[model samples]
Target: MAISKHIIITSLFISLLLLHPLVQAIDQEMTSNNRGGSSFAPKMNCGVACEARCRLSSRQNLCKRACGTCCSRCNCVPPGTSGNQELCPCYYTMTTHGGRRKCP
Candidate 1:
């Protein structure tokens, strides 16, 4: 009976570890190609940790400023530019729809 109980506990522990979202979140975060660099963390910059993860608001001055600096390093096209603005969505859509193609 004790052996069975220990096996149950061990299996439950391993199952919970596998189920934890943090595992995947951390993996995704580490692999992120965001070019703000490893120096900037959304956690440290957000003032407090958010219960759920979210992207920084593009409307915020900080995000806009950061994006202006960082977007060139990312695969994304700049949000506003003459002529290219219209093409940006199609580019993004195709890229997303196909899944992780090399940036132009």
Candidate 2:
């Protein structure tokens, strides 16, 4: 009887130990879902957007730099080579200290 009690207790202890990680994983998943899926920011392909916007610029390097900055901040870039700022209001509204449009 003594040995049987020890076996039962050990079995329960091992089962609980094995289940601990599973419980934690489920809890983490629930928390992440509650907070809107994953905690990481949504990936944006800035290279493609920058290329499209900056291709027409005489200073291609500077165009890319400015476009990248706006893209990172707004998480968006207006479509086309130029003149579609209406598509992205945030990108459109951003301006330089000199009162010029900051985004490409």
For every model shown, what is its TM-score relative to the native structure? Answer: 0.23, 0.59
Q: What is every candidate's alpha-carbon RMSD to the true fold? A: 14.0, 5.7
lDDT of 1 by residue, 1-104 (tens): 99999999999999999888878897787777465455453323221211111134434554344333333343344333222433445333333245743222
Where in model 1 is the C-alpha error above 4 Å?
A: 2-19, 33-104
* Residue 73 displacement (Å), model 1: 14
Q: Each model's number of backbone clashes?
A: 0, 0
lDDT of each: 0.44, 0.88
Q: Which one is best on TM-score?
A: 2
Winning model by lDDT: 2
Q: Could you tell me how far off, in angstroms, the CA of residue 98 lies in candidate 2 after the best superposition?
A: 0.9
